[model samples]
Target: MHNSHIFDKTVLREYDIRGVINQTLNQNDAYVLGQLLGLIVLDKHGTKVCVGFDGRESSPFLCEKLSDGFTSVGIDVINIGCVPTPLLYFSSFFFNADAGVVVTGSHNPSKYNGFKISLNNKPFFGEDIKNLGIISKNYSYVKKSGNKIYKNISNEYIQRILKDFNGNKKLRVVWDPANGSGGKIISDLVKFLPGEHYVINSDIDGTFPNHHPDPTKNENLKQIIIEIQEKKADFGFAFDGDGDRLVVVDSNGNALLGDQLLLILAESVLEDHPGGTIIADVKSSQILFDKIQILGGIPIMYKTGHSNIKKKIHETGAVLAGEMSGHVFFADKYYGFDDAIYAATRFLSIFSSKTQNLTEIISRLPKVFNTPEIRFFCNDSEKFEVISNIRSRLISSEYKVNDIDGLRVTTPSGWWLLRASNTEPALVARCEADTLEHLNQMVSILSYELSLNNIKLPISF
Candidate 1:
């Protein structure tokens, strides 16, 4: 039997192991990963692990190989079958496992499949990921067969998610799971929720026949928008492939941005935990942070990745935290992990308590014009360099900049962000302003900066 193997360097990402199946990731890679993770868990005095997979074509085969490898190392495995990423995270706490791994590609396309891991409920990332590479190159293990037990905790998960649903409104709601892992959970959840529910694409289809599972792009949310408008529902909710991120559509079929949703949720949280610290990624609108201050809550800007934000929330004891990508973490009355299903319940509870509709509530907030996150191809090798150059230039010119993750520069009119995507070989950019004219100017500034680096801003802008 082989004792060592090297992984594709590209798959060892900062946050998780991920790559296109068959091409960059294969069963052997999964087996090796299982072995490496098993060794790590054993070292930490942990005897059991929770394993789960999403509704991806390659997920089952990969999961089996992973389990085989884990068992070969005498590590007991608690298999949770196919489920959303949040459920996998939840399994860690429910089973009291020392470690956990989920076979999922998250918001990536259907052809891609990989893993997200947690150790003792903490996200295993950054240097922890790098250490996997070093261990895989040379490691020794005694092969003693362990046990694998299958567990179906979906009902318990559903019950826990509904436990926080305090909404008494019988409002009509539309749910679109995009045929991903969250479909079954949402299908089961609506039965208990006190609302007129219409669910679309709840069938588990690995092919994702309807559309791409990502909700961040408005294009993917088209179906939900139409359903909400045609059905005249109070609102709608959409989920990404792994169901951790959320996209909400109002009664007018308008999809709310991640920051907007954060602002809405913060309003309720701040009331309960007065003078509490609420965290948001740097990409969030300035208006969100300003409003937090107005609500008598402390607002902190942090790095963009979910792992980064989650860790920050834990370290600071913050009541709530979120990313512009729709990953919201709540420490109040729930685990401090992003669970879109739970978030949906909380949102409904808050909305039911109010008399005004979603659109009206949104209208009352300060207005700001901003571009959706724009991503352009940039080689992984050079993406960081490009951001560094821009950061240096901005600082030399005495521009107010936040470099927590990348460069978020503030100007007289508004602010702009240029950051390298941690999960893809692309540079992500966004800009915001109080007026259309100022928004255009901010975009122009962003474009000019990219031009200096021999990169063209996406022409669609």
Candidate 2:
């Protein structure tokens, strides 16, 4: 193929391709990506590719160009229309396609868009993503007539999700999709669930006018918490823009962090699979890992990215895994991919099976003080060097450090972490301890470490 197209370097992320719409990404880039992906599939002796997009305004046009590129290469395209990222993943299996792609920006602002790719049911990321850039500049293209088929798998996806429901009691539940792509499907799904359901922001609005689509932020979760309180519901579930992340709120209108939610899911999963392996990201609270060990399951702390956790789960044969950023994966009965809708269903099933409420179950866990992920400004060029400096100093001082993804130092009272953000010009930090005073001490220690490198902690404990 003589169609020489170059992608902006910033768009080629570690896990997926993402960029500001029109500024750094456009129709031509999407078209070229489809062509390259189609070529890769054919090279692997595959014939069909599944394509889906989110509710972003730019998605449909990009999806159109992407599908054209796929068909131009003699690779049949199974278009799943506008749906969540998980549904795109499900389509790959349902249609027995060789490759899958989704046009989504995930939890980012509306002005951004990107693609997530998969080959043969495994995540196509890291070096796989970097290779696309090289291949786009130079590659032989196949010219043939391949077909594009439009299929709506909403009914099938909803049916499969509900099939896992084995609850013994009916409960009032609230769902907040935050006007994301999952709104339409979740609205349809609640109709079949056995409960009094309340769905807010059910419209699929690309603007995300209600609030940011990220459920991890407390400000974004306020609406759902309010809805839960007003409706007097058992609990509420909030999903990110592409429906790949989840946040749960108890009846008391208190939001649960991702690690806390993961512990809840782990209890049910370990009950079914004794001594199973459960993976949590490095940034997750140590309490979560300890709880998993106490539940008679093996806990493995891995990297922070969703793709990293997913890869680790595949390698370790783990049944469940999650990150602190609300990306939860369940491979016990379903595919091992992050799906907020499926996670919500599983949580509901678990909740309805027990007599204890979410608060009660969570209250049984050991108490600890921790800080939210704190990201401070640091030049992208210098962030890694700063981390390296800190790590070297910590190691020289005989600090117990885990450098899997970044530097996680084991303190006497608890632990503290310092890592560079993968997608931004910043450094991330967190500290945890058994008491408020210990937590403050940990924060001071982290601050002192940063100060050694001419940096200061943005917030005080």
Candidate 3:
């Protein structure tokens, strides 16, 4: 361990360990991470660990070394092989493992790679991840394990989803895995899905030779939309790099935002479990909260991180929860981790139900014009201060401001939110109104406020 490079604090983020390969994280980092994580699991709980990785080129190499480190620590390792983050999460419960770790860069660029970890089915994040950094600095050797096992979890996970619905109707689905880990498992999973699936960019390429894997951006879904229209498919689905999040397009190639999809899923879940707790992050529209209330469900607004959202869900025992960024969690019929594949399956199930088409379902919701997430570049240290200044200004004004995560100020016409992104060095702003002019007006007001504080508005409407 003396030759191993020290772990950087920047790479040990609040939610996960992520960094550029070779630059911040490499094989030695992976090995040390494995040892510390294995020790954490063994010391805190027991030795059963489930491991999976994404389609990144460095993922396999890291997974191999990480497994060796875990085995060296006297822990039993279950290698679920290359799969999505959600698949790894699902395997955690399916295999009854004590902990799990998914090697993925998530929606980051091809050069990035990281781990999303869990202990006893809960997110091992924040101080937990930071604690690993502390352990790494001390760097003590652990006794070698004579007990290590490699088991396959695909069959169990696949069976759980398949058992939900029999192959009844053939659905024409245009799926773009975006050269992600989902590409490797989606084809096989859909084989029993009773659907004529037309998959594009399904090859697992770490270079991302097609397009970026983030489905939230409209530009990334352009190819999938075109394929859906050309193939006359019922709908098209796109997954982020690790497949924990999803973006949907209808039969006519209309893109459906995550909140819209949540509305649809909420309706279905509320039907089965009325008055159940439904949670959404602050980034989501007020329309979701209103809809949840009207449908006899309790709506709880929470913070904006996936791990934060999951922890809230477990604490409140919320049956369903979602984020505007396409991360949807369902505790109603499945485990509560965000799963894009399972969400797509649920969407398909709804499409085949007695309800209306996706377009029709969306049309039934109240119309509100909303700006997509507007990110403005800012120094990480100064971003929070900028938000604080804006908050102080809003407090003196004649607007109702909610400072749950950032600043969500409400007016008669609409609402505007200004918050710092947890993952990136940018301030995220969004405005929504019943009319386009009102939305624009809100944006202008936000810009003026930022300008007054000597903080240049980094985004334009």
TM-score to true structure, per model: 0.97, 0.98, 0.95
Best by TM-score: 2
Off by over 4 Å in 2: none
Model 2 lDDT per residue over 1-461, tens place? 56777899999998999999999999999989989998888989999999999999999999999999999999999999999999999999999999999999988999999999989989999899998888787677758879999999999999989888888678999999989999999999999888899999989998999999998888998899888988999999999999999999999988888899999999999999999999998899998998899999999999899888888988999999998888999999989999999999999999888889998887888899998899899998999999899888888675689999788998778899999998889999999999999998989999998999899899743
What is the Å distance of residue 314 in model 1 from its true position?
1.5
Q: Give, for candidate 1, the lowest lDDT window spanning 10 residues.
A: 391-400
lDDT tens digits by residue: candidate 1, 327-438: 9898888889988988988999898778888989988989889988888899989999999989878887756898998899998889999999987899999999999999
Preferred candidate (lDDT higher): 1 or 3: 1
Model 2 TM-score?
Answer: 0.98
State the lDDT of candidate 3 residue by residue for 227-302, as single tens digits: 9888888888999988889889988777887788898889989999999999998878889999899999999988
What would the TM-score be for candidate 1 when compared with the true structure? 0.97
Model 1 CA deviation exceeding 4 Å by range: none
Cα-based lDDT at residue 230, candidate 1: 91
Candidates, ranked, lDDT: 2, 1, 3
Q: Per TM-score, what order, best first? A: 2, 1, 3
